[model samples]
Target: MGTYRYRVQTSGFGLFLGIAAEATRLTNPPTMNVPVSNRVWLDASEVNNAFHGNRLALNEREVAWLRVGLDKVSGDIERIETSPYILISVRALEIFEVDYAEEALAPAIAGWATREFTLTPRLCNVSRDSDTGQFTFDWNE
Candidate 1:
C-alpha cells in the first residue's frame, strides 16, 4: 500500500543480499509475473567469489529465499549469452509489491530498502591547509 523498500540490486548494506532475496525473489506467494528488469548477471562463480570462505550474513529463512532467487535466475539466463548467471535486484519493486501486504515480511523489507547505495569518491586526491582553509588537489596524470 505504501512505498516499497529493500530494492537495491548490488552488494553494499541497507539490505543484506540474503534478506533482499527473501523479500523479492523468494517470496512464498510468488508475486512476480512480469518481465524482470534492473538485474545484472550473477554467476555461481561470482557468488562463490563474493562469499568464498566467508559466512553468508543470513539466517536460515534468508538462505532459503536466496536459493529460490538463485534458481530462478539460473533458469532465466540459461538460453542467453549470460547463461549460468542469476540476476540480483531485478524486479525488486515488483517482487516487493506482491509481498508487501504481508505483516511479517513488510518491516524487514522496508528496513532493507532504507540502505543507500554509495559510490567511492572519484575526484583526485585532495588536501586542505589547516590555517588558511586553502584546498589543493594533485590531479596528476
Candidate 2:
C-alpha cells in the first residue's frame, strides 16, 4: 500500500486546539482504524473547485458536524499503512507556544489522518539543532 501525507493548517482559536489538548492529556491517546463502509473516491476537480481559493473556517462544533459529513461522503477513501508524524516549527506562532502546540496538535493531526485515510497515525517529536539551525524528526516508533 502507498503512504500518503497531507498538511492541514488551522487557526489557533479553533476547536482543533481544544480537542487536541484534551487528547494529549490521556496516557495513551485514542487511535482510529475504522473500515470504510461506502467506497467513494474524491474527485480532484470537484475538491479543487470547492476549496481552491476559499478559506473554510470552522469552529469546534462545526468541525464535529463536518466530520460526520465527511464520514458519509468519503467512506471509500484509501487507508494509510504507515503512522504519519507531525512537524511544527518551534517559533511558528507567538500566542501558542511550540511545546504546547506540539503536544496538542500531534495527536490531533494524527486523528485527522485516521479519520480521512482510515489509519492510525503516530506523533513524532521535532528537535532543532542549535548549531545548524536545522530541524529533525524523531519518529517515536
Candidate 3:
C-alpha cells in the first residue's frame, strides 16, 4: 500500500526531517501511545497520488525507521487501507535521535512527555563507520 509522511515545523526551528514508510498493518495488536496534539492521518491512495503514484523518496534508513511506526500501529504485517495511523507536531526541541546497538528490536521515536510505542524490526544496519555516518539498512535481515 501507500505510506505516511510526518513533517513538523516550529518557530525558530525550521523543520525537522520528514519521515515516511510503506503502509502496512500488524497481525497482532500492540500497545501504542502516540499523542496527537495536532495531527493528521492520510490514506494510502492519497499518499500515492501525492508522489505520482510512486514510492516516496524516503531513504533506506528512513524507511526502516518508518517500519517501526508501521509496526507500532499493528504487530502483524497485514494491509490496513483505513484509519489508525500516526502523526504529531511539537516544539523543535521535542525531536530526538536514538543510536541503536545490538538487541535493539523494533524502531521507535520518543520525545519528552510523549507516549511511547513498540517498533517492530524489519531492517538491520550493516555498518556505521562512514564519515557521513551512513549505514546500509539491510531489509533481508
Q: Estimate, for each residue in 16-100, the C-alpha lDDT of model 3 and write its tens digit.
A: 3322323233333323423211122212222222323443333344434533433344422223223344332121111223333
Please report how far candidate 3 places residue 51 from its true position, in Å.
Answer: 4.6
The residue ranges of model 3 lying beyond 4 angstroms of the native Cα positions read 1-7, 14-58, 75-141
* Tens-place lDDT digits, model 2, residues 1-141: 122222334332222132211111122212431221222211111111121334334334433432432343232232322222211101111122332323333334334435435554454455555587443445464
For model 3, what is the alpha-carbon lDDT of residue 118? 26
Q: Model 1 — TM-score against the truth?
A: 0.23
Which ranges in model 2 have alpha carbons more than 4 Å from their true place? Answer: 1-112
CA lDDT, every model vs. true structure:
0.30, 0.30, 0.30
TM-scores of the candidates in the order shown: 0.23, 0.25, 0.25
Which residue pairs overlap in candidate 1's backbone?
A: 6-113, 14-115
Clashes of 2: 2
RMSD to truth, every model: 17.2, 15.5, 13.1
Query: Residue 45 in model 2: shift from native, Å?
Result: 11
